[model samples]
Target: MDVWEKCRSWTASQLQETGQDCYYQVISDTFDGTEVTFADRRIVMAASHDYLGLSADQRVREAAMAAVRRFGTSLGGSRAISGSLRLHEQLEEQLAQFLGQESAAVLPSGYQANLMLAPLLDKDDYVFSDLSNHASLDEVIRLGEAKERKFLHSNMKHLEELLTTTRAGAGKTILSDGIFSVEGDICDLPALTQLAGRHSAYVVLDSSHDLGVLGPKGAGAAEHYGVQPLLITSALSKSLASVGGVIAGPAEVIRYLRFHARTSLFTAAASPANVAAALAALEILQTEPERRQRVLNLAERLHNGLRALGYDTGASTTPVVPVLVRGRERCLRMWRKLCEAGVFTAPMTYPGVRAGREVLRVTLTAAHTDTQLERLLNAFEAVGLAEGVLPEAGPPREYAPVRITRPTMATSTARGEEP
Candidate 1:
């Protein structure tokens, strides 16, 4: 066989032998409130991103239905062509007002928005990205030939060091996630903004996990920290309980993006029903501020309870909490045990998290009751203790120590290897 055929065969063999397979266990019924039925059991969902639980709200459903009746289903063309609808315009306006921005442009997905934005900036520009940024943002930085510098996760000091040391020729931009999806730790936006300003760098904040979950009125991390960036991007899938993405920023930049961003110009716009549903969800978010507070309360409750039960939930302050299992086998075993106990959770492994740091990610929603929370806690404790995955008491031992050695300056021709 040729080299190509040999490589292909090897790839297939590797996948068959070593791939950790994931299968979608079928569900038989609709999602009602906080419960979902699969087979003969009703599992309490602790894995979804419906932070404020607006996905099943009557108002949102009604709005979606109304839009379906009026506009049918899909937008036949991209937004630049014939897909731009009145509903889109309305939602964009509402989002801009809510985010305190001059303008906003809705995209097909958060992934696409991130992928499209980095390429639009000139190649001479340098993108200072977070080391632990989401895969989508990482892909953009990698695929585009933009000069990329990764700083330690959420470390403002390291970011400033890079900014100060970088050559003046490159146009600088700092990109970070407002709320890290995995660690659940929030970015220090105030410090980041100060550094960016000092270095004359543009800032791009991705609030995909923070939107509708952080801030005073769920305006996101920017509002929480009182720092406005040059660009803000987020997804509607998580908090809005819909499907789409939005980039909110200055009007001129938005207009420029509208003309140049191929993902927005070429791909079909979001469905009419989804757009209307998101708008209604936003309306609810605006009027019912207590919903956001309730979700926060539930998150706090879960975090405290989990910590008390001797699980390692690292530095999380948002609705997303991760039970650090640290090994792939252990993480999968915990997930299977939880599933058998009628509690669904998403497990994070290998690429999603760092190697030797796999975890079981638990997300909280406002619709979940106190009883459900207690049930989840019980299941975790039972499974963790029974399987010897978690300790009975005391903090976990350090995994491994890292040693840092500074590079020493060498004189020219001292080693006699190179001039």
Candidate 2:
């Protein structure tokens, strides 16, 4: 049999032949932050990670353009070799301050930032991770030489059990996402950090989806929980409106990773334009509180709207909202119909989720107008009713929106002390 036989006979190809594949189709966006054009039709963009809606902002665009004009695109080499720039250092310093960390190190991507931990670990170490964390965090555990254990998703009781009975290692680390992307759920960060402290395990919060959309100050999950982990990792591509990622923590750890980790030493430096744009977006995220506020307000709007429309929006408290469709084929059909109705969404299936927990992942931005949201809701109402995803929806019998609370008290850290 040909080694390529399985690739040639994949199920996705069949879905593509019938135009049911929704994953990689081109957007041909009109450059507006809130909408996209596809097949000559304008659609409200309900599935995107630009939480603060700064990716298409004119100020961000101008910063990117100015950087490109001055530095030309690529940095030409890795930072350890010849690509280190003063701008990179400046961004790191600013990020350190913003994240309440002593230091920060930038990487080529969030995936790279997640991978940074692997080089710092050994056979004597172990990592306990959430089963529902982002894929990048999952890869860190899977590829690392350290023994890895998966606790139940957000079950602090289960995590404590694993930490107590699992092999007593030379070192222990807990890995989790600030926002569990697929489930649209926020991690019980306070509980997780408390467990980490009791176990004397280091904590790593992967804040890929929450950097600019959570916390009163927009410092992601650490800030949200009033705790500082051993490290916090996040991507600029999501909220900072640019490419690349950063790991923020103590000065010693950042220094160690900068020199030892192949993620920073071997990978080419991020382009000047992307870095500058991210710096500018970070400035916006810091100064403009309204943007992140708008994101949460809009998220509440969408989440409550979906719940009232008789759809199961499972445990979402952030901008990432997942509307459960239950069946693979039904989920695909819902996505297709939503797209046809000028509303775009992401479809989650078996490998991305569990066997029966398929959903249409819907995300909103600060840039989306009320009319756009209403339009999206209307599309849902129409398609949901037509597809039997909804049954006689005027309002759900009981609708309870998740309320976000800002707890000012600090939680436990790696050493069982407040940072």
Candidate 3:
């Protein structure tokens, strides 16, 4: 065989041998709130990020259908050309207001937003990133190649140390997730904001998992901590139960991004139906604060219950709860068992998490009823105990502990003043 053929054969064999196969499974019918039917069984869903549960809400559906009736499916051209619609503008305005910013730019996807923003910075600039940031941010850093330095996950002291010591001239951006997707721990935004102020750095907040799940009014981490970021980027796909990304900041920054960001300039804008759906979702979020409270209540119940049942649910303070099962095979086994018992969840292994610290990532939605939450708790308790995977009762072991320390502000040299 020639070189190309040999390479293809090797790739295929490696995938097969490593159990890295990717395929789609068809759901028998539509998802009913927090339950889905597949393979002649009804499973309670614990793996969704639909925090407000607006994905199947009647008002959201009606808005989307109305848009579809008025405007067909596709946008037909990029946003700069014939794709910019009134709905897009309205959504941007609403998002800007909701995020407490002067303006916001909408993108097709959160991944694309990250991909576009990183390359916009100059080569001489630097990015101070968290070591355990989402893969999208990792891709951004790799693509930018802009003097990247990583602080330990959520370690503000380490971040400040890097910022003070690095010699990368003027432009510095601190990028982090407001709420980590996997571990579910909240970021110390106040400390980060103070550090950014001390170092004269711009802060970028990715609130993909926090937008509709945190804060009193579900306005996200900035509102939760009373800090305004230089730039705030998030996905509507997760908490908003829609499809798109938003980048909110000052008006000039948004205007510059609209004309220069590769993802916004090159790709077609979001379809009218999706834009409408997201708008409706936002309206519902503003009107119904109960949905947010319900999800938080359910999450707290689950977290406390799991601890009582002797399961190591890491330092999670949000709706994204992860049940730690140490090995890859054990994690997969627990996933399969949970599925067999009519509870569906996603298993995290290998590249998704560290090698030996696999887990079953369980997320909650507001649509989940009290009975459904109880059922999910029962299923986990049963599966964990039956499989002998539950840790012994008492103080839980630290599966992956994150420690954050604040940095002292530096004294300025001019006239011995503290800036």
Candidate 4:
């Protein structure tokens, strides 16, 4: 068979390996916060991005409804045309203040936000990105047609080396995820920003998973690390419980993007309801710091429990936790077992993560209760042991002297007691 036909045949093997429809699902009872009912089977949702639980907030819902009542549903054209509204401007201003930025612009989606920001780079510019940066950013780099280099994930030395070797006068832009989605590790933003300053490079941080969940007041990884990026991009759909994206930076840059961002100029603007909902969610994020703490607390509990059970959760220090399952087939089995036991989680396979480093990404939210968390813990413990992902339940053993020459070859190096 030809290459295309051979690849097409591999689709069947993938389906058999992963079990069909692992991603697509419909939850009945839309307002349910921590748990979802699928086909009459209730499951604790551990694979969602609603970190602040603002998606089900009454105030947010009411605000959205109010917007719909006042402005109707759709904005017929792009923001630059006839789609702009008072609420859009209000949301941008509020986001700027919340994120400690000089200005902000709202877009149709987070993917679009990156897509628009990318084209700002000229032919004489170069883009440097972390290896684990989001797919959107990678796509943007390709679309922008700029010379690019990918540094090792969170490796400042590699980035610095690349910067030192680049053409002296060429403009440089660094793209990275403030909090990696699958690994759930915060970027070394302070070091990255320092390097950017030294090399005259602009840093663009994708804080989609960090905002409304990271930092003391949920100001994102930049605030958590006490560093500032040249531009910040995020998804409101994740924590703000809305259906749009935001790009925030200095006023002049935002002004330029407001006109040059073709996605913003060509696509319809975010609905008034989404803008109002995001505004409400932002207010809640500001007023209720406890909500952020709750999510973090739950995450810590889950992480500790998994560790105690001798399960490998790799380098996670945030609400998004990845249970390392190693191989694709093993991860699929673990995920299936968890789902059957009433815990829902998403699996990360090749391309989403490195080969042989598959994991189940479990996201925690403020709305998740103690009972729910305990149940999830139990499910993970049971399923992990059953699938050989963890050692058999037994007393923890003292660490043995072992050397890891290559960090990439090692698995589950996060804090743990050997079993």
Model 4: CA > 4 A from native: 1-14, 17-20, 393-419
For each candidate in turn, give its C-alpha RMSD to the true structure in angstroms. Answer: 9.4, 2.3, 5.4, 7.3
Give the least accurate 10-residue stretch of model 3, judged by summed lDDT. Answer: 410-419
Winner of 3 and 4 under lDDT:
4
**Model 3 per-residue lDDT tens digits across residues 1-419:** 57698667768667544434321455676574589886789889888788889999999989999999988887888989875888999999999988888899888888877766765567888898987678888888877757888999898879988999977456888889988888888888778878887777888889888898776567787777767778788988887788888889889888987887667788988888888999999999989988887888888777777777777678777888888888877787778788888888878776777788677888878899888888888888888877887754633554333221111222221111001
lDDT of 4 by residue, 1-419 (tens): 57698667768567676544465667775434688886688889888898899898999999999999999998888879785898999999998877778899999788988887866777889999999999999998888867989999898999999999999878889899988988888888777877887788888999999998776667787776656788899999888988889999889999998888777788999999999999999999989988887887788778777777776667767777888878887887888789888898988887687888788999878898899888998898788778766666562563222111111122221211101
lDDT of 1 at 417: 12
Question: In terms of lDDT, which candidate is strongest?
Answer: 2
Best first by TM-score, ranked: 2, 4, 3, 1
For each candidate in turn, the TM-score is: 0.89, 0.94, 0.89, 0.90
lDDT of model number 2: 0.84
1-419: candidate 1 lDDT, tens digit per residue: 58698767766456433224433566676464577786578888888888889999898899999999999988788889885998899989989888878899888788887866755557788889998788888887876777889999988888988988998667888889988888888888777877887787888889988888777667787777667877788889888888888998779888888887777788998899989988999888878877887887888778777777677688777788888888777787788789778788877876787878787899878888999999899899889888886686643544221111111222221111110
lDDT of each: 0.79, 0.84, 0.79, 0.82
Question: In every candidate, how many clashes are there?
Answer: 0, 0, 0, 0
Show pairs that collide, candidate 3.
Answer: none
Reference-based lDDT, residue 237, model 2: 92
Better of 2 and 4 by TM-score: 2
| Regions of candidate 1 where Cα sits further than 4 Å from its true position | 1-19, 23-25, 392-419
> Which scores higher on lDDT, 1 or 2?
2
